[model samples]
Target chain A: MNKTQFSKFVEYLLKNNNVIAPQYNVEAKLIIAELKKTSDFYMGTELPLDSWKWFLLPPKQKMFDYKGEKMTEALPSVKKQIFLGVSILDMQALTLLNQIFEQDPYYQEIKKNTIIIGTSHMPKDNFSEYFAKFEENKLEHLQFDIFLAVQNGGYKIYTGSEDGQRFLDNFKYKDYKHVEYAGPIREEGLDLQMVSVMDGMQNFHDQKIWDDLGKRCISCGKCTIACPTCFCFRMFDKSHLEQGSGERNRCWDSCFYNEFTQVAGVAPSAPKHRLMATTAQKIYFWYEHHFVRTPGTYSLPGCVECGRCTRACPADIDIFQTQRDILAARNKKKEK
Target chain B: MINDYQTHNCKILKVESESSDSKIFTLSLPYKDFSFEAGQYVMASLPGFGEAPFSINSYFNEKKFIQLTIRKVGVLTSEINKKKKGDIIGIRGPYGNSFPIGIAKGKNVLIVAGGIAIEPVRPIILDAVNNPQKYKKVFIFYGCRDESAMLYVKEYPSWKKACDLNVALDNPKSKKYIKGPVTILFDVVNIPTDSIAYVCGPPIMYKFVLAKMLEKGFRPENIFISLERHMDCAQGVCQHCAIGTKYVCKDGPVFSYAELKDFKTWLSPI
Candidate 1:
């Protein structure tokens, strides 16, 4: 558990390669940028919506390119990526993602070559409850590689990974003088914003709550689009009628809309409000109860709380607040 | 790409348009001994249009050809309906669990179907008719909207002769129609508690019909209902069709009423 000053490590990365991080104000407000000049640059609080999801699974990347009878695999090559400002939720999701991709039928290509660079948060957002769960400490899972804990004077860098160790071994840092302040300290934050979506899912079958919520929905699919873990998509075959031009493309699909279930020609139900209802229900439903594995295992609910869904939403529905409302409504229903 | 999933060039040998949109197409493939069980399904494929899974409407014993009574509901089935003899096609497994004919042996069997779900029940109807000594008694309660929606009209007489048949169309007033809903037949039939009932239909039909069967004293374990799922991969790899942890493609397309006992609501497997 040898520690080194974080400045020494940041200096090393700046000298050799590109490093991305959210700069913090003296009061620790988030500034969206990598430290370009590093003249008194500090790490920010919670990470953005754009975390490591795309680093492994890129949105709209070709799964397999087919040429007539021939097909080519779009496998990603290994690269060294240093993600900055990782919250507890991000770290937890990373650990979960590693387990899934490394399961029996290994999704070997993505897992083989990726390392995460996590930063300790100073609790800017009120949602940093993960600190309380495991005694305000971070655990190394398969996904996250290096963790840089920022102390008041400097940083205590825990080189937990081989890749991290190798990078630090050759590089220089300040001193581990701030190690005392930098170690695990408890701050009563909300533990993983986990709604026992299980209990909620059980009660809300055909609940009238969706009736009001659906009216607020615009069906623009902003929620699914902004969700880091919404990997559900649909396939489309676009070819010329003469059978000459042939192209198959699958795009991100949202169940919150009518077209998602349009079989043959007629869709079974209304697409717009119903999709919102379905999406709301699916997320709130008792997914983990039935499956031995949690539904979140598939890189979903790993949302970094970017709130892009709120911004992109024309309906101006705050998803975070609505999610809480759902849990509360579920509880009320249970009591009834 | 094709190992366990091998493709066989198949074609629609004959098609009987039973109604406006519903057509029972008899198909021919090169392979012999294409043995399927009652209530099992096969994937029919057409080049450039991809493939669609259809229930085995024909008897499972046939090695020569396959039968699918498809209602033109989607793009695939619409294109499939247009397919005729010599049209190039492909087929995969008779994937999934089927109706338990052996389970019904020595017990009075009641088969109930609503809408197009009867397509899957067609083969079972044949099995019950051809093999009478295997079961003590057999009855099929088929329900539809009208004469236009009723399928396999030509084969109805033979089904009646083979076993008891109750046809319930929505329009009982018309001369071509029968009175009362198929659900009412459960009340009319003198099925004892020991009888095994099979119900297949839309969710609404299953809700009401299953209740009637239960009310009539058929135990949950003794009743089976086929489930429809949002199938992506017919293989278990795709969890699209999951109901709880059970994959409809693998664990069942047909589950006992007891299986539905725990599913709070019929939701796709996450």
Candidate 2:
């Protein structure tokens, strides 16, 4: 399909669904938002400021509603939505989220009514070797509705799901190949970079590195907000004006906050029972979650290596540098 | 798709004061065939307040109702304490892996608890009391701040009939209990090193109790410990109760020492 055909396809999708695509905001900053026109769409290698998670898993979601001792599950009421111009890196993040929240009804409700269209556009500063170079074979490992492999003039269309194939067929376009949805694991096994970093953080203990990071990190948690795969959340209850009425909500929570690990009965008069008391411990937890816990749990890389966290950090705490430090520490220990 | 966060409304059947700051509330089973094992907990909540995890202190075999001995600790528990009989509260789960009762069967059982940490282990104690012949011997070592902080005092007579029950207090007003931390009772009593030990306490108590157990020639694999953490979703999706790769809410609130020893962040964060 040529550039003219792709514009017509976008127009067809916008007729019945809310099209979310990468576009330049008023500030000229690239971000993922609702696309009003085909001209507003910015298809480039540069990553948007925010990820597509805010669409699938909202920042604050209502889990349940309560009234006079009765509680009912509050699944999200969603409309048909299409995510266009999604980079391959963010696709990996979405795939991981799909696995993590497979049993979550709230996430599933929004996911069922949504369509994902991925592109082969690789970010300029991409650090992940797994996604550095996009290939037709890589599409088998990724989860998406449709994928556009950028070619000479337009794109070589590939359909990952039946929805993608139907969407294209309905647009009166059939020049597309359908790719089966392969499992998350690659045929070769776990990625070497993910394993090495996980081993480095778990087996190789370096206090100096974390302590240095602790000093530099302000615990502002900007990195968590920016990172695509950071899905830590806390459940809370909000009361309405009427008695015995409210909703149970889960909002995005960051591990950098003091209250993240805080338990009940934590008063000055009572004993101090906080697990992550110091900034260093909290920072280590944040890294450990990405490098160690996620891989161990899901057999998937936690950090997508998007460098969004590094860009969002106010303290200039470089995640890539920290990972290098962890690797260096592991190598030094191995030598001994 | 099943909503994992969905909670069931359970009516409070009975409320009895256990200690100065705690009360035991018996609640009707949330659903039919709702069964739970020892060391498991339920996410108890009330509207307008929040939710918190509480150990299911009731006997595992009881079909009629479940009991939760909630101590007035934080905002949620304070609200829970105010609830009376006939009041309804939201509850979900019997989440997390239970104690290794099968492994402990036919072996000498040693139960150690400190303060309110004894709540989760009450089912195990009750099991030993009911069967008595299931294990070779059962010994309970409970430590508290004072007499006022002691729990399950009324059940002491029945428990003592089936097992060796020893009580220790930090500050004792009378000669009813030993005058020291629970670890001191380790020296006072001659428990067999070959026994299966179950321990639950404040984070500080684990260090001393583990040291004392190790000193007593107990094997790491033979001991099971229950860890406490601030939990939100009992389904393990929430990261609050995460320790290393394990979600304490899902993988465990109870874990064997052998499994826990490998995790550096089990007791505290690295």
Top lDDT: which candidate number? 2
Worst 10 residues of 1 chain B by lDDT: B1-10
Model 1 TM-score relative to the real fold: 0.71
| Candidate 2 wrong stretches, greater than 4 Å | A266-272
**Per-candidate TM-score, chain A:** 0.67, 0.97
lDDT of 2 by residue, A41-137 (tens): 9987999999999999899999888888888888899989999999998999999999999999999999999999999898887789888877899
Clashes of 1: 8
lDDT per residue (tens digit) for residues A133-175 in model 1? 3322444332455665655665455655667666766764323
Which run of 10 residues does model 2 chain B get worst, by summed lDDT?
A: B1-10
lDDT of 2 by residue, B160-232 (tens): 9889999999999999888999999999999999999999999999999999999999999999999999899
lDDT of 1 at A260: 46
What is candidate 1's lDDT per residue for B102-189, written digit by digit as tens?
A: 8788878888998788888888788876776777778888888777777888888788777888778887557755677888777766
Second chain TM-score per prediction? 0.92, 0.99
Q: What DockQ does predicted model 2 obtain?
A: 0.69
